[model samples]
Target: MTIAAAAPVMLCAWLPTAPGAATATAALAGVAALALALWQMLRRLGVPDPDRAAALILLLPSVALNGVIGAHDTLWAAILLLALVAALDRRHDAMLGWAGLAIGLNPQAGLTAPLFVALLINRRVPLLRWPIAPLAAAAALLGTGSVGWTIGLRPLLHEAITGHLLAIDAPNIWTIVQTLPLGYPLLGLAIAIAIGTIATVIAHFAARPIGDHDMIAAALLCTMLAAGLLPLMHERAFFLADILSLALALVRRDRAHWRIALLVQAGSTLALLGHASGIDALTILGGGMTIAATALLAGPLLRPAANDNPVIARSA
Candidate 1:
């Protein structure tokens, strides 16, 4: 099984069954993973105890809501963070492996794979080592019985194409379009174009050899892009961006990162409330904050550091 999916399954196998036992167990596991990931990420970024504590405090709500109550997100978030930590340590193979396991858990996790590959290639890792990622992903999928010839590509394609075609309650440009009589397919196309354009620009500028900080920045950008651009995304998707941005903020000592993280947290919380209450207004406001935060974050994240040389930064 994909490690994310396997986690709960293994818990069930070993633990006694009771009302809410599974959820409680899953929540415990999620909380543990999140705490470890957060601690490791902070240490890697050289964050001081006070800053680390602040970051953790900022993430606590998300950990409770998404990580504990909504356990599906926990494993993927942990895997993603671990992958980022591996990347920061220059452990290319481990990064790729963790990323692959993430993708196997949730196809959406693949959104960051291209950026990871690009960064690795820019680092001049051997071409031969690159295939490890896709191979690991495939292996995880097969091991999980999530893919087979009879099952084929049809189910996967259908899920990808139709799963989140509508904005539903997500906060993004698509939510605005959903009310304007636009077709869902057309809206999807528009989002695709927008993401493509933004990604192209990021790729152009990100061609330089990247540093650990830059990789973290790239990950933050990718998470924001996915949360903003993807159709049918729920509030939980922002958890990744929120936590990653907090990490970046601690590393860079930039208030902008913290601001964006708070914006995302606020938006996500509102979206969840709206979803539970069936309140359109709350969802709308939440989405607006999310979009604004993403736009604000993109400006500083895309620019090169003013004092550092790209080559020197990369080699460091």
Candidate 2:
């Protein structure tokens, strides 16, 4: 969390442009805030030596990658994970509020909102607490950004609000639809695939609270696959989705999900290699399908296990 939030700030100090500097600085501040939140959460959880070790092992590579590649959106991604960790453990309503605000600040963090709502179907949180943190976070980001870029900030922020959906890097079913001409035969098939994936996620969330995490994990994975399996996806969009899948696997302590997660990770790694080594499309798509199938299958299998085992909830 600290690394994801901090590295960008560190990088901005050396960059030459003003807009880049402002963006980087805001990201840094957001990351720093997230780090503090994570620390407070760890303390609340009674941070053990093992927890610290595990966090370090997991986060170091993440931080390094974001820093090296200058992946700006990752700071918000870390915030979403921290919120998930807190929420999964049944933490206070304050954490959910923070997660929501983080979502408003960066739409990528919106993933936490649906996950939390799914959690709320079976869990309890005060309603008032729901709006405060998100409102405050939105106010802060907008107020701060306005100080730097005045006249047209509203329009710019509005663009930023929905930017995640518009970005070509979105690895969802639309990617495939985007590949086809408006009336192409594959367009209908792509729509069906998207509806099915979304319906599966919703059904899983609706059926059992035990599978909330798995639902979120599967949704993200499917979104990524739907994004990448499309003929048009670039490689980098798979990165954060893959990370979230791995984390979900760890949280569930399910080997099957882990295997699926690894397959996706391996596919991403191979895709990166393909980009670097100029590998053939046949090989790339073949590997991608394997990864996509494994990830896509993981949710249903793991979700059912959670519903079947009441003992798992007690342990968590």
Candidate 3:
């Protein structure tokens, strides 16, 4: 509850006179911020068509669904992008500060924060007192527990996993499985967590220097795995994953990669618009589209980067 509403509430605080105004502001600000970040990141990566590529986010159907339809989830993507930029610049304090806020923003993004922090620590960021990165980094932990305390852990856990949707409207493994003759919601949830875990482990080992494709690809895997499979998810679930996929595509500057980004996002759109318009076929087809598109994406992206650190590289 805290994670999901943190961004919206913060925005509302600024526009205290009218929450409607805040929602309007959040929608525009989140996508605008994300687009700018993508543009800058592309310029840094030396993509020839950075301008064209960065504008891609503006055209995604899911953007209209979430941003125009009053969903605040885009803020999660924006904050992570800011935090990633900070990490790339070695501004560890800023990174932690954004990361902490991200942990308080969305569960999929928050779930990836610990893994990101763990990878940062593994990179020998040295908790030495020269910079207060550790102190700054504690932001991820500090304010994140308030919601759990308020709601009680058991209820929170139930809300997160067990007590939620058995038939998610979005695509991925669970949607595919649950739509079968006999749905296994618990089993599907277990498999989703396992997929996310595998992605997390791969990301832990594949931690490249901040600027490399490995870093973004690894991060993409961490978030996409969960957004794709977890039970509390819906059409908007793939929001971060869609952004990351496009980012990875832009970083690589491959036409095929761009197509991959387009397709997965198209799937998200299918589910979103379908549900909104009451088109069940589009939703189901969107699920299949998501499954097919992500399958093509995950296989290539999930490969471990060549060893740069023995501690992470070695199998235990």
Candidate 4:
């Protein structure tokens, strides 16, 4: 297990030896980190009403499940990545540290770190720092020196390839996928995710020399697409996407963004409800809302922008 998951176990050293006490402590820490990260990212994005906007994420069922109701490390993993994004915006040296920690916590962050690095690299932070995340992930995931490669990321990769289910109340495209052989649906899901990811990258780079707001918007879109496309997903998979919707709304402070945020929160909540109650109707509706939210999330990036690529970026 990664440090994030092992935290509650380790907390036994400082707190009561009971599993419940340690778990509560760890969950509290994750919630606190999440709260602070939401505020800092919103402030850095220049949200005029950070307090009010921060409250919006609390309404997301995924966030509530991961941060309060469960002792899940996914919340901490996401906050660390959010901190890394904030560090890049501030041109701080802590970017690598945060990236390393986030990726260490959740190997999934390894997929998103490089893009953030590419966005903010200049003479200030430079391009050299961009390679560390992948290298660290490779060493942990592929290197023979470690056991993590065998038991950790390997299982995740296996699941991604041969999904255990069509959809676990995730309310995504796969939810609509008819019951078929695992190979066929997993193959289709992979292709769809690849195409969506490519489009997301295009949308991101089209706003190249991307601004902080642009980054937030792109993160919102990308996370939504991931939640909506990936197979074998659960309601909690929308955790980051649901939270980023609020962050994007705050950054834009507009009707459309707010609408999407509200829709995403509601959809994720419904998905969670369906998961708990075994109601396919609720999940189907939630999936529809999720898909709509993702489509709207990409709208802004689809718009025209000035010089996405600066052939000769300004000197620091």
Candidate 5:
């Protein structure tokens, strides 16, 4: 809560007269920043057409929902993109800083931290420099004081442990299995760890030096894994994965990838709309779309690399 509170405080300071205005303004700014970051990442990845890339990003339903709803997720999306840009640029300090801010805002951000670490390792970055994220998170903790942890971390952990945080309301596998006689928390944690490990290995071996494609692919995989396997994930948790998939589709210009992106967007949109309308059927359809999209994308992402394609190779 303390970390998420930073957005409102920062935005409201500039628009004291209207808190709603501040939130809307922040969401707009976050959307713009996210587009810019995506553009930069696509360029860095050697996309043939920048305009198409921008269109693809702007057209994503998840992006549109976040922008219009003025959810804090818009800001988190921007932060994640900026961190990806920093990693692509080989700016280790900047990557760590953005990632730290992400972690401060939501512990879920830690799920993607290993992708950055993989990037650093692929580039042979010093192990000593890796501590920057933890240090920055500690600094955020110190700045917030003990009250932050007491109010924030405790509840978050409790929700996670008891399966209270499961994405049963979302169109996800959890929704299907939730009613079954099983130990949910343990099952969810085991699945998350297993999938996360596979994603990390794929990220490490797929691209030497870790290009934008590799980073984005790894992020998409990890985000999907988290959303599908975490005990208490929300449907909105797939927003990052949806965005990354769109970006990947645009960059790769592959028909199949583009189709996968469309599936993700459709699924996310249905889930969001269904949740709003209290329609369980629509929610199930949405979750099925997500599962299909993730499955389709996993093949290309997890396939053994023939060689590091230099065109999409990392500058670092």
Candidate 6:
């Protein structure tokens, strides 16, 4: 999956510098990554050939969005997610391949999901191998002058890390509400959110009935929300949530939960559409909606099996 996925990125590395080179490179990379991901997913789930077409139908809108919007980061992020899922299903090679795709493109790409999977699988392997890819990629990009030192490596690295400061000059929606008094009320919000998060973690783990995949979905959702909530969150940071949300939808298998999961994707699309404010509205509104939707879709989990799946019944 990684070789096939990264092939386009590798090819783009050779494209003559042009006005749309980066965007074009990103587009090719996105398509390749999406194709590999879908193929791997179809294989892993053993979706019947007929159903496979339907699955691709659901996926096409997203794939098309990635290509058209040049959202390579999120596209690649989704690839990492599929890899992680593949690994969880015991497809370790695909996981490594997905991670390779990330390293070849962005160091921070799907970095968390693979590490999480490593912990779930063989912790030691992820600990040792994950960093190697990005580090080596960085060195190569610098050493081989794929990124020219003057206008490329140094500046790219500098901008990649420090550029956010220039891009984002204020607090995000969550911060705005939390810091209503202004002047970095972040301290209080940070402490409260931390406490709440820790408590949720404890509860989630202590409950123990929660499946490993469920826990992973929850963690991704938490991380996705945090990425957006943090000060100086650029539009790009939301890409971090791409896989986790999809994972949540697939693994949870509750229509309501799936709808909630869709919010992250929606938010991401809004960001690409230059609608950060809209994304903020959706996140805030969507959180409440997800809980209600979950209650309806997954009520059986909280009730007797006789509930007949409220969502499915309603739809019928």
All candidates: CA RMSD in angstroms?
Answer: 4.9, 6.6, 6.5, 6.0, 5.1, 7.2
lDDT of 3 at 116: 60
Model 6 TM-score is 0.60
Q: What C-alpha lDDT values do all the predictions have?
A: 0.65, 0.49, 0.61, 0.60, 0.66, 0.47
Candidate 2 C-alpha lDDT tens digits along 1-316: 4344334433443444677665556455544544453443344434444244235323534333444444454455555555655665666464565565455435444433444654555465567666665675676367436444332234336644554332233333343334345654454464466456544554555455553344446445444544443333444445556655555555455786667666656655555545545654423553555456455555354446664654223332
lDDT of 4 by residue, 1-316 (tens): 1234334322422453366665666566665556657776776666777777766655656766764555344443544545445553664445564565456555555444435544554324566766665564454344322322132355456766675576777877677663335445364655677566755665445344655666666666656665576566666667666667777777777898889988888888888888788888788888888888878776656545444322212211
lDDT by residue (tens digit), candidate 5, 76-193: 5666777877777778887887788666655666656657766776677788888888787666555434322222244457756674534646667666666457754555464766
> Which window of 10 residues has the lowest lDDT sum in candidate 2?
164-173
Per-residue lDDT for 303 in model 4? 49
Q: Residue 143 deviation, candidate 3, in Å?
A: 9.8
Query: Which candidate number would show the highest TM-score if scored against the true structure?
Result: 1
Query: Clashing residue pairs, candidate 3?
Result: 3-105
Q: Between the candidate structures 1 and 2, which one is better when assessed by TM-score?
A: 1
lDDT of 4 at 304: 52
Instruction: Report lDDT (Cα) of residue 237, candidate 2.
Output: 45
In the range 44-99, model 3's lDDT, one tens digit per residue, is 55667888988988876777778667766666667677666666566666666666
lDDT per residue, candidate 6, 94-211, as tens digits? 5665555554455445334424442434333445655544554455355426543232234336654674232231113552354245545354565466456444433432333333
Q: Whose lDDT is greatest here?
A: 5
Q: Check candidate 4 and list the clashing pairs.
A: none
Order candidates by lDDT, high to low. 5, 1, 3, 4, 2, 6
Q: Report lDDT (Cα) of residue 163, candidate 6.
A: 45
TM-score of 3: 0.74
Show where candidate 6 strays beyond 4 Å: 47-71, 89-104, 107-179, 185-219, 222-226, 247-253, 273-316
lDDT of 6 at 156: 36
Question: Which has the higher lDDT value, candidate number 4 or candidate number 6?
Answer: 4
Indicate the TM-score of model 2: 0.59
lDDT measured at residue 174 in model 1 versus the true structure, 0 to 100:
64
